[model samples]
Target: MSQFKPRRPATGAAIAVLAIALTACGGPGGSQDEGAATLTFGVQAPPNSLDPAQLHDGTQRYVWGSLYDTLIYSDNEGELQPAAAESWEYSEDARTLTLRLRDDMTFSDGDPVTSEAVRVTLERTRDTAGPQQNNLGAIESVDTPDEHTVVLNLSEPDPNLLVALAFGSGVIGDPDTIDDESTALNPVGSGPYVLNREETVDGSTYVLERRDDHWNADAYPFETVTVRAIQDRTALFNALLTGELDAGTVDETQAGQVERAGFTLQRVDGISVGQIVIADRAGEVVPALADVRVRQAINLAFDRQGIIDAIFLGLGQPTTQIFNTLSPAFVEELNGEYEYAPDRARELLAEAGYPDGFTLTMPANLFVQQVQPTITQALADIGITVEWEPVPAQQSGQTTNWGMYFNLGAVAPPSRTVALYFEESGSQNPFGTTDPELDGLLEDLAAETDPEAANGIYREINAFAVENAWSAPIFLQSTNWATRDGVEYVGTANALFDIRVFALSR
Candidate 1:
């Protein structure tokens, strides 16, 4: 999901903590009977559609995660775990993956969760032109030899394939109604919870009733799960303070106040990397950006630490590399390669035959307004003039005249991150800048089967990208979650917010 700025309170002191009775047995509706348990979660937005194939990462996972069971599960630390499929083995060439499913599992509609269901779900997801379609592009076909055995035949070796399955690509839907238009609003899956249609209000509140027949029901602690969409951050914070929400995401600026109000704060660091993407590295738009020294000068122009302190409230780590800290490709030395040196930056600009610097055009949107002034001033100091073009958030991607723009890239495994941002076909590589050395390294990484060998190639790619100044990386973004008393949540390193990580403190 693209990063967007959330609305914050006008002033920190403007919010008042209201004393509302916190119930021990129920949700936002106050107290309930002895055996009833509920979890009311506040999300920034509601799911655009309930179809698993159409779902994207981030907030959408708050609902789809509980409603469907993925073939594999990713833990808090990003380790692969078994979910719908009890066991899986990769072929010697790493081109085929065999899965063994639990025969006892059944969907909410009482249909058996067989190998055919997995085949149909994967095929449907691959066929649909959705955000997750790219995740399954390597699959040549799916084979189901029996009711419980499913095998995936790949066209080539995919190092990130397993990790992809642990996310949206892995979500299994009911084959019977997955294609029906009604299934977009009403979903059917073999999951821990069943959507309560009577209590659900589309686009506002969704109530998911626990399914007793689900084999993995014990993993989810709440009997009833209510996901509410509160777009305004201030209102969501108020809901947490007033005991209307058991858990919700809060900005770093509100972390102190949230803790003082008796809510437990959980943070996952390095979920994303905020950077200035120099899209026209080939200098197709701006001639100066084509110079290696010019690109390096741009990297050294900004004071990343200062921006992190002022804009992020000191909740991030300054870095010059795009790879997340947890990734195997991350190199500690590269973080300090491009120190804040305005004099050196100016020297580099002069050496590149642009002593007066050049004018750069970039798209401006509400999502990037918070850091626009700082970026403009930083480039101005190094002799570059920035011309801002007011563009709607929806139209930001369509406008391609920009030489550079602020972006928050999702952190994932090295291979997946490379595929999504660095490769020619990458979503983030809008300009399609290609280097022969980088291309060869990426091809080697893709074909390598051994974990150690693949990671070594990733490190080489990381270093090469940094040396070339692929982007002026600022810092790693942190995602925070706040929970009321009696509730506990463990955040994941990824950008997704999975409800399964939540549980009762007791």
Candidate 2:
């Protein structure tokens, strides 16, 4: 998952609430599981391919944990806790870090998690030249001094490294586990859960059983887990209602219905926003969406509240900025005042010379379809008629052409979230235009060791995004689903799709 921005006053509070909520879930002394438990996991959409190193997704992140453990972890409370390494010390200069390893841990194949293995795994991640690479950007070098120890030499300090490790790409695996085929296709991991079996027929699905000798047996919550690729929400809801699915992905509109049907709605929290990005493709002057008035007009025209009521089913709240509703960064003061403004929208439209109206094309994949109708109505109100079509997902690991395209992205991290989606070459910045100042902001924040300093930059860029109207926000959606009654599951912040925390009570 990517990060979010802190533009609105309410963002600070949301991040605080999320941080507090995170603490109640996991920690050094974990809560005791009542007893033996088995869980069934459900995935809305099956992975295009199960390669963890490819593109990190929520489902993929959870699945990676099922098979592997990371050297470090960003626990539910957003703190770096030990996974492979028990404790670590950073140099006073903040350039180097030394880690103490766990001696008892072993791979499923009975191989010990040797210090050499830790060094090698990290080496692979840093090998930009390697097939499975990424997430080790901070560290300039890695080495192992002793059997129970590893050292990382960083070019700069990175407090977010632990959180970064929490990503699917950061999970540590046995060096020998890498098969000639895709590591994600079927990779061996050192996690508390192990793959029990794979019954591939229609679409691929895998079953995971808890390891009896799990390294963190004291913290292991569930005995078994399963993931289902159910993309259709209505079908998923029906399955939940009929006891077929443990739970399913839900729109905010359906939240009340689920509660009424005797189900608990575990708030699906993520930094994703339903922003309609007006990309400024680098070539043309008005490139993709260079007209600031045009961007503002689109924002003004979209009846965000209407979408909340119609598509999200009244449970969704309208947001003016791109920060997640759950972040402490989104405090009360920053909560935006830019409610839906129609006349202003029309005026902005005229300013952009699309006075009468403009035809806008909206993309709809299974995910986008959830809000399609509401978006259509919102655009119509501002003289912008929308043409809805399901844009086929890109075949390569690439995004669709940057333009006035309809799409949804999860800006998961609030601190420097947009940078990954904007600045870097060949990164997710779909608009294609590059700004040196914006890239500089990203660089400062990425390398800033101090949270307060990094936050200042975050505020700066978020304000810039809003003022420049670089992006138009729709709704901040969650990336989770649920089972029917009788399933004991916690909607984990750290692990989005972790069925490992689920257990059937009845």
Candidate 3:
């Protein structure tokens, strides 16, 4: 079991200092037009990237809510249901799959959603000349048989295709919506929400109205939703407390204040692994964190309870295993490998030739505040010295990308994320680290359409990651947000607010 050490609200003086900024931090919600229905929401930060090709990170994760929609989506159980493609068929050869587009869709600007658009969108996913091209490498080609129909031929059979489509990046935007270097300020897509207005001055915020003509309107609720970029947590909470907002994201630590103030709080198990990446492995130099035991020392030193307390105000639980535990394809044993033990952690560091300990830097942000400090202090108990090197939210420094620092990526399929982050040609692998075996495993797994076989590949990769210490995982962030009375809750694993089905009742 992992112990947690939560970061309490800094002391009396700190709270007093924070209290003054509380209103700026603690925002008050606002109301929409009397009869015009737009659900006003709050976001802690603005999105980072608008280009679908290079979109990765928390802000881009939310951009998914406005600018795109995927071929498939998940219901509460996470089973792939339907989206752009109304229905699909797998060829007898099992390598070719046909997708039937819903003819009832159109871009909010009134451009018809043609089968040609589907072709362009997919081909873009696999085009070397395009962004995210390698992410679609497993796909051999996309052939459109006719309007309303597209046949995707894979290099091999892949059962995870359906799941992959539900991924945020899998969202299909208008070929025109993408410009020469980035996504157009006005992106058009067949998604349920249409971006009517975007204010980019202080921070970018969008005003979205539900599309009554949405391909799936009957299932959607809100007709209009306004998403406000509230960068500070305290401001976000204040807005929620004052009923100035309907629903949005919040930190787990503020759960107590939210409860004390009398508001409804709902949460789902975190599905994303908030991880710490280690680079610069040249075989035998102990690569900063080359040893699994040393990595374990870090993981064990993480006071899960301490984080829950100090950071989360004791609001969430320590995730014992990888988020794979909730994945349908995960095997029980792989989730078992990432367990915690502090004494054993000491033993491992001692075995790794660091009996007296060594100094290391932890690149941090909000996620780091939640765990790294505690992990740093815990490692100190066993004599490990750590300095928190804050990585700015700018382009990664060349040296740091190759040697130090960790950048966050929202949770998606293991194959999808690994393909983007660790593969030889993948953009996130700034360190030039490449394992052909690991790459091949990704290929084999992606090609496996069978849930069982694909799952085996994920397990295999996790085993490899544990042994190699590719990155040290802290814990999945448990997503929780709230709404005042009469506002329905729609919590998603990704924390996106699906405006269509949301309803505000007085």
- Index of the highest-TM-score prediction: 1
Order by TM-score, highest first: 1, 2, 3
lDDT by residue (1-506, candidate 2, tens digit) is 12222223336677566434433343211322434444444555565544444535455455656677776665454445567777777677667878778888888778888888777667666664322343466678878888888888988665445555555545566777653364656566678877665543223456667787867654554565556666666777776666555556666656677777776667755436677666653424233256777777777766677776766565555665676655534533433545678899888878777788766455566656666676677778888777765554422112444355554554445532453445443234544566777777777865676677776777776766676676677676654455555564554443334444553433
Per-residue accuracy of model 3 over 1-506 as CA lDDT, tens digit each: 11112224247686555434322222223233333444667865555555555544444445455557677665555555567777777766568777777787887778888777777777766663433555555578778777787777888665445555665446676877665453645567777776665433324467666676776653444555667777567888888878677776676667777767766677765646555565544423236465657766666666565666777665444543344445543455544554656788788888988888877665555534545556666768877776776664434322433344444445555555555556664555545576887878877864565667767777777667655666666556666767655455655564433453244443
Off by over 4 Å in 1: 1-35, 201-203, 283-291, 346-369, 383-405, 430-433, 492-496
What is the per-residue lDDT of model 1 for residues 191-212, given as tens digits with 9 covering 90 to 100?
Answer: 8888999999988899999887
Task: State each model's CA lDDT, in order.
Answer: 0.80, 0.60, 0.59
- Worst 10 contiguous positions by lDDT, candidate 3: 1-10
Better of 1 and 2 by TM-score: 1
Q: Which of the two candidates, 1 or 3, achieves a greater lDDT against the reference?
A: 1
Cα error, candidate 3, residue 450 (Å): 3.7
Candidate 2: lDDT of 370? 62
Ranked by TM-score, the better of candidates 2 and 3 is 2
lDDT of 3: 0.59
The alpha-carbon lDDT assigned to residue 228 of candidate 2 equals 62
Per lDDT, the best of the predicted structures is 1
